[model samples]
Target chain A: GQQVMQIPQYQHVQEGEDFTTYCNSSTTLSNIQWYKQRPGGHPVFLIQLVKSGEVKKQKRLTFQFGEAKKNSSLHITATQTTDVGTYFCAGKKHSGYALNFGKGTSLLVTP
Target chain B: EADIYQTPRYLVIGTGKKITLECSQTMGHDKMYWYQQDPGMELHLIHYSYGVNSTEKGDLSSESTVSRIRTEHFPLTLESARPSHTSQYLCASTRGGSGNTIYFGEGSWLTVV
Candidate 1:
């Protein structure tokens, strides 16, 4: 069985501050995807990382995949109120294609 | 956006009652999945299906049963619901090609009393 573990179960930051969350897997992953869930909404797809040591940026948000493909991280610069939500990392396994999701990091940004 | 749908967005039932959560996707995806999540908690895999006539339990052991008889439908059933079964159930599907982003339904919130 594969397990995806995320760090900083909960995080709070002031407006214009920076935030980051990390994801680690027990086994190597074929790919990793990130999702964001609002306070009372369904999870929404954010981005995906496949190549080792890969980095992708979406505006002020940056996503990085570890060199070993077993870890990933999401970093947000200058957080805003709208950035408040839980961020989850899902690792796709090579065996069955089933995704193993991390517990997620809940972010709270204050004004 | 994905065309995934779930019925009875909210449910409140007594213990020992039978309940079924319905899920359907029109994206022509071959992979479907069910996940359970508590308030402010992590998402846990409960069940999944690769295609029609294919079903498998996920990492989490659940008392619910799911069936996939058609390409667009995957329903989960609980013969005797218990108070511990109270949680939010999410249905998702993936195209398995190009972008591997998983699309999730609105989710069904169940409260067993």
Candidate 2:
């Protein structure tokens, strides 16, 4: 069984500050996906990285996959109050399609 | 937005009662999954189906059972519910590939007393 671990279980940041959450997996992954869940809401698809050392960006958010494909990171630049939510990283191993999800990092942005 | 749908967005039942959570997707996806999530916790894969009549238990050990008679529908049933069963159950569907995106439904929040 594969395990995904995320750091900084909870983070509080002031507006305009930057925040980053790291995710590491016990096994190499075929691909990794990121999701965001707002308070009292369901998780929404954010992005996915398939290639090793791949980097993707959406507005103020940046996602990177480790060169070994066993770890990843999500960085938010100039955080806003709207960014208050939990960020999750799910990794799918080469052996199976099932994703091993990391215990997400809850972000609270104060204005 | 994803076309997946989940019934009984919230439910409260007594112990030993049987409850079924219904999930459907209009995307016509062949792979569907059921996940259990606790508040501020990671999502756990409980059950999934590769296609009709191909249900499989995930890494987590769940007492609940599921049926997949239709390609677009997957339902999870708990024969006897308990207080420990209180959690949010999310239904998701994908296009049957490792690189495809999984679309999740609104989720069913079950609270067994």
Candidate 3:
């Protein structure tokens, strides 16, 4: 079975502070995706990384995929109150079937 | 919006009752998925369908069964509901390749008494 683990199950930080969440997979992945879910809302796709050692950014958010496709990370610079939500990392196995998601890291930003 | 819709935003049913949660998407996406989640928690994939007549169970085992008779509709049914079945169920659909994003419905909150 394939498993994806996320570090820091929960996090709290002051506004404007930087935060990062790491995701690791027990098996190699064909592609990895990131998602965010606000309080009481369904998960929303943020970005997807397929190439090895790939890095992508959206405003204050930066995403990275490990060269071996076994791990990934999401970094938020200068966090804001709107950033309060659960960040999840998802990966597709070699079977190319469905996407498996991590437990997620809940981020709480305090002003 | 992505046009993914789920009926009965909230439901309360007694144990031993049979219930069905309806999911429909106008996006014409061939891929549909059903996931269960608790408040402020992780999403557990319960079922998914690549297209009509194609359904598969996910990592988490579920007591629910799903049907994909039409490309735009995928519904889940619980034969015997229990208190443990109380959770939020989300429906999603996606087009294009695996790289495409999944668009989710608001979700159906079910509570069995």
Candidate 4:
């Protein structure tokens, strides 16, 4: 069975501070996806990384995939109140169709 | 707007009652999934369907059952509800390709008394 683990289950930071959440998988992944769920809302897709040692950015958010394809990270620069939500990382194993999601990191930002 | 939708956004039922959570998607996606989540907790995959008449249980074992008679509809039914069944159930669908995005419905919140 494949497992995805996320670090820093909970985080609280002041506005303008940076936040980062790491996700590790027991098995190598063919692709990894990141999602954000606002309070009382369903998860929303953010981005996906498919290549080894790949990096992608969306505004103040940066996502990275390890060269081994076993780990990924999502970093947010200058946190805002609107960024308060849970960040989840899901990984699909090589040649597998199902996606295994991490426990998710809950982020809380205070102004 | 997202094409996926779930009915009865909130539900409260007495114990031993049977209820069905309806999920529908208009994306014409072959792959559909149902996940259960607690407040601020991880999303656990309960069931999934690859296509019409093809359903599979996910990593997490659930007491609910699902039917996939149509490509656009996948509904979960609980024959007998209990207090432990209180949680949020989310329905999602994807285009079925590597790295493809998964779109989720607003979710059905159920509370069994």
Candidate 5:
């Protein structure tokens, strides 16, 4: 079975600070996806990285996939209250069928 | 927003009672998944289906069962609920592909007393 490990189980920052969450998979992944879950709400898809060493940006957010395809990261710049939520990284191994999710990183931004 | 739907956004029942959480999607996705989560915690996949009449157990062991009679509907059932069953169940669906987006329903919160 494949497992995804995430770091900094919890994060607290000021509204203007930057935040980053890293994910590492036990096995090489074919693709990796990021999701955001608001308090009391279901998770919503944020982005996906397929190519090794790929980088994608969505406004203030940037996502990167490691060159080894076994790790990924999500970074947010100048966090705002609207960006408060749990960020999860899920990976699909090259030989696996099910997507394995990391224990998400909970982010809290204070004014 | 995705066209996925879930029933009884919240529920509370006594132990030993049977319960079913309904899920449906209009996106015509071939893959559907059921995940359980505690408040502000990581998601644990309990079950998934590739399509109608096909189901598979996920990484986490669950005491529940699921049926996929139609591509648009997938329901999870618990034969006998227990207090440990209290958690939020989320239903999600995605099209066939490696990088496809997963659409999730609002989720159903269940509590067994």
Candidate 6:
């Protein structure tokens, strides 16, 4: 079985501050996906990282995958009030089809 | 936006009652999944289907059962509901490809008394 762990279960920051959440897996992953869930809403896909040591950016958000494919991180620069939500990382093993999800990091921004 | 639909956005039922959460996706995806989530908690996989007549239990142990008779429909049924069963259920589907994005439904909020 594959397991994914995320750090900083909860974070509260002032608007325009930065935030980061790290994810680690027990085994190497074939691919990893990030998701965001707003208050009272379902999870929405944010980005997916497939190649090892890959870095992808979307607006103010930046995603990075470890060279070993066993860790990932999401960093948000100058967070806004609209960034309040829980970010989850899901990892898929090389030999499995199911995606094992981490507990997630909840972000709260104060305006 | 995804074309996935979940019925009964909210449900409040008494204990021992039977209920079914209906999930349907028009994207013709072969992979469908059901996840349970609590307030401020992580998403827990409950059940998933690869295709018609294929069903598998997820990492989390759940009392619910699911059926995949059609490619578009994957419904979860609770024969005897309890308070512990109260949680938000989300239905999602993926097109089955490398780096495929999963689309989730709005979710069904269930509360058992």
Instruction: Give the interface RMSD values of the models in order.
Output: 1.7, 0.8, 1.1, 0.5, 0.7, 0.9
Candidate 4 per-residue lDDT, tens place, A1-111, comes to 899999989999999999999999989999999999999999999999999999999999999999999999999999999999999999999888778999999999999
**Superposed model 1: Cα runs more than 4 Å off:** B97-99
* Better structure of 1 and 6 per lDDT: 6
Candidate 1's displacement at residue B6, Å, is 0.6
Checking candidate 6 for backbone clashes, the offending pairs are none
TM-score of each: 0.97, 0.98, 0.97, 0.99, 0.98, 0.99
Superposition TM-score, candidate 6 onto the true structure: 0.99
Q: lDDT at A95 for candidate 5?
A: 66
Docking category of candidate 5: high
Tens digit of per-residue lDDT, candidate 2, span A26-95: 9999999999999888999999999999999999999999999999999999999999999999999998
Docking class of 3: medium
Off by over 4 Å in 4: none
**Weakest lDDT window of 10 consecutive positions for candidate 5 chain B:** B95-104
Two-chain DockQ for each candidate model = 0.68, 0.82, 0.75, 0.91, 0.88, 0.83
Model 6: per-residue Cα lDDT at residue A35: 97
Residue-by-residue lDDT tens digits, candidate 5, B1-113: 99999998999999999999999999999999999999988999999999999999987899999999999999999999999999999999999778788899999999999
Write the residue-wise lDDT of candidate 3 on B12-92 in tens digits: 999999999999999999999999998877889999999999999987899999999999999999999999999999999
Per-candidate RMSD vs. true structure? 1.1, 0.8, 1.1, 0.6, 0.7, 0.7
DockQ-superior candidate, 3 or 4: 4
Every candidate's lDDT: 0.94, 0.95, 0.94, 0.96, 0.95, 0.96
Residue B103 deviation, candidate 5, in Å?
0.9
* Candidate 2 overall lDDT versus native: 0.95
Per-residue alpha-carbon lDDT of model 1 for A68-109, expressed as tens digits?
999999999999999999999999877746778899999999
